[model samples]
Target: MDDRHSRQSWLEAGLSQLAARGADGLSIVAVARELGVTKGSFYWHFRDLKDYRGALLQQWEAQYTQLAIERMEADGGSALDKLRRMLSLPAAGAERLGLALRSWALSDKEVARTLKRVDARRTAYLAGLYTQLGLDAARARTLAQFTYHALNGRFLLGDMVPAAAQLDLLLTLLTAPNDEAVAETAV
Candidate 1:
């Protein structure tokens, strides 16, 4: 009787479990039970709980960050269009998983470091997009920081997300004729 699931299945189930119940749901036995399999099945898929967790972190970064950036870059659109699409991605179900990771980061140093690095990578990408729209490097980076912070804050604050038109206006300010004009208008 082959009760063993594939490694990908194991990793995916772990992510779902984490998203559903935070890091407490990450135990090997818990995930095995959720999958209707025995704890031995987890051992077959990963070396141990630590190995499983490392795999999960890698999978999360790849699926949520790297692949997302790749898909956005592949699209034929202006920087503003890509920014709009990027902001809208949480609607596609990455939010809960991402929030779960953020929650987990609060308690785990390793996760905190990974989250920071991932965020910097994302912010740098945003800065590049803003720069493409003709903003100076310093201004572009500042806008990226605000955009990144607002996006994450919205993820946490739920009902506080700005409407589509507001987001469009914000993106438009990045391309305004004067640096001080964009800065003053934002405030």
Candidate 2:
């Protein structure tokens, strides 16, 4: 591999390691050994552990964030359908990227901060979508929070909730407007 590919390979390898073993077991020496390269190779791509972590965050944002937003914004469906897909993302991935990221955030301050920011962006984007759907600000905010927590909870539940049933519940609740109060219609 060339320089760029080599660097990405190590970063990806690092994330995979973190996923399987958590950050406590991640070490430059270990990643170097896995790649069959010297520790020096890790330096060529990353300045230090922090740099590698930053790269991992960047990789995550690049690889997953937009795809998720796009999935949530898919055409011709009730917002509930979009919401259900967002909730089901973690279970759908064999690698459990969502769980991995959540695990990383538990031990890494920077990762935690970035996760919060990414979540805020997602929530805001979803709130805007809700607003466009005719929800009031408070209702939109509540829906956004509900959707965010629902998805996170869904990831944690995994096998406990049958995938199909969990998705069905989310679609039913999230797609429908908050309450059937007078003077307001569900989007």
Candidate 3:
């Protein structure tokens, strides 16, 4: 492979290993073996293991966060609809990503911190979006935070709890209204 493609292949191998095992198990030799290359080739692409990790974190965060931000911004719909879609994405892609990162976070502080920062930014943006949709500012922010935790938890527990069913329960809880809405609808 060419230099650029070789580097990308190394990265892909590292990430695949990360997903299968955890970040703690990631190693230059392992990556090299996976890619059918010598460990020396890994050095040609990255300065060191840390450099490889930094690059991986940057790419994962930027790509995932940008896609999420774009989805939040592009759709012209009820905030609830947007929220539902956002919450629903886990079964598709985000959940798998979150699960892998969460496992990494348990052992790697740098990865954990980076993931936390990215997650906070996304949550804050969602909170702002929620506030625009007739929800009280505090309630909106709380719900936004809850959504992140819920997604993380649900996906982590996916082997035991069905994703669709868990998402439905979460959606119902988040969208349920206050006493006034209840009384007002009581004809």
Candidate 4:
């Protein structure tokens, strides 16, 4: 809790606040108080609340989506392995922030647009992975949609189901051969 704070620190504080009290509670004054710093410290990093929010969104995009994709791509594994790795990645509090952002999106056009773009990027990445696993384009897209939907559903539901159980179901859907997967899962 130093007087001097980094932009990343401010963003992290913002996400934590977003999780605890929703977007309405996310403000420079609140975050500054949370960090035991002055408003000047927050202003040092961002031009204003709007600028802070934009940076926060960018950080969320990078941490939640772009970094995940990069890690999957860099892994030395087959498409199935990569897919498994991506699915099994730990939430690490990002899920709560994501849920908060989605809720905020319901009333904020800018947040809605950003969430839409993030979803598109994520689904496109999943589709590409399915394609690399030898699925046809249509099948890949379908699987991508299903996979992304399941992920967001889990977040929306606050993961009441155990993590192991959810992963088992997701891995079964994602790893099984296409025809067999459809037949077995009745999807």
Candidate 5:
């Protein structure tokens, strides 16, 4: 813990706090205490709590969604390979942060809107990858939705199901042929 904190450091602390305690736990005082600094340090980095929150949302969006899309696109593999890589990408703390934001969205319209936008961007990226794998538009969209839903569901279910087993089912669903995917979704 440094005496002085960078803006990024504050944002990271905010994210961790959000994950651990949800929106109500995110405060300048809390972040400052976590960083072993005074609240003045937070004010130095952000104009106010609103500004800090906006920056936190932007950081989450960039790190969780935009950077992920960049990594998948730059993977330089077959579309299927890229898709698998995207699916298996290990984002530590992402599930916690996602759950926190989703809970926050229930009480904040802005957070809900931001969450919706992020979900759309992620879903579109997955659909694009599926389209590259030669699935038609309709089927690609269906698989994309299913993939996103399964991922979220896994997070929601947490330890109720084994991670390995859930991942296996996800892989089976994602890598299946377009016809099979459509049929499975229909059931």
Candidate 6:
């Protein structure tokens, strides 16, 4: 096999390593081995491990977060439609990568900062979609938080994820207008 891997290949192998063994799997040696090359090959692609990790995070954000949002925006659907399409993304794989990144964040400040930015961006995007659905600013932000957290939590739940019927009900609650009010009897 050819040993001279491109920078993209290094990033891709790093992602695979991250997914397979969490943050601990992201060392230069491990990624080099994954690419069937020596650790020295990593220097040709990255200045150091910090640089490599930064590039990996950048690649992750560009591909998984930015591209998905771009496509959904281009699709031009209703808020609920776009939300459903976007929400389906977490369920379509990449859970391991996300979990690994989060795990890495626990012990690394840079990773934590990057993860925080990514999460906030994703949550803001969800809030934007919810706002488009006619929710007030506060309500939209709150529901977006719930929906975003729940989507991530669903992965952590493994087989404990709610049934389709249960999820449909939650979806309705999320998408429906919250204008219903109880009649005041004492006032």
Most lDDT-accurate candidate: 1
- Deviation in Å, model 4, residue 138 alpha carbon: 1.0
Question: For candidate 4, what is the TM-score?
Answer: 0.85
- Please give, for residues 1-187, the per-residue lDDT of candidate 2 as tens digits: 5553398889878877777667777788888877778888888778998888788888877666666677556654765556545555555542466677778788778889988888887788777767767788887888887877766676667623447975675555554555653224324
User: How many clashes (backbone N, Cα, C below 3 Å) per candidate?
Assistant: 0, 0, 0, 0, 0, 0
Query: Ten consecutive residues with minimal summed lDDT in candidate 2?
Result: 178-187
TM agreement with the true structure for every prediction: 0.86, 0.75, 0.76, 0.85, 0.85, 0.85
What RMSD does each model have against the real structure? 2.7, 4.3, 3.8, 3.0, 3.4, 4.1
Clashing pairs in 1: none
lDDT of 3 by residue, 1-187 (tens): 6653387787767777776666777898888878777898888879998999988887778767876688667876877677767776645444656677887788889888998899888898778767766678788889888877766676776633447776566555565566575455443
Point out the worst 10-residue segment of candidate 4 by lDDT. 154-163
lDDT of 3 at 108: 84
Residue range 1-187, candidate 1, lDDT tens digits: 4534778878888998888888877788778877888888888778988888889999888887898799899985998899887776554456688889998899888889889989999999999999888889998898899988888777766635457987777666855758677787788
Ranking by lDDT: 1, 5, 4, 6, 3, 2
lDDT of each: 0.82, 0.70, 0.74, 0.81, 0.81, 0.79
Candidate 4's residue-wise lDDT over 111-167, tens digit each?
999999999999999898888887888888989999888777766666544476666
User: Is candidate 2 or 5 superior in TM-score?
Assistant: 5
- Top TM-score prediction, candidate number: 1
- Per-residue lDDT value at 49 in model 5: 89
- Who is ahead in lDDT, 2 or 4? 4
lDDT of 5 by residue, 4-31 (tens): 5888899989999999999998988888
lDDT of 4: 0.81
- Superposed by TM-score, candidate 1 places the C-alpha of residue 147 at a distance from the truth, in angstroms, of 0.5
- Ten contiguous residues with the weakest lDDT in model 1: 86-95
Higher-lDDT candidate of 1 and 2: 1
* Runs with alpha carbons beyond 4 Å of true place in candidate 3: 1-4, 92-100, 159-178, 182-187
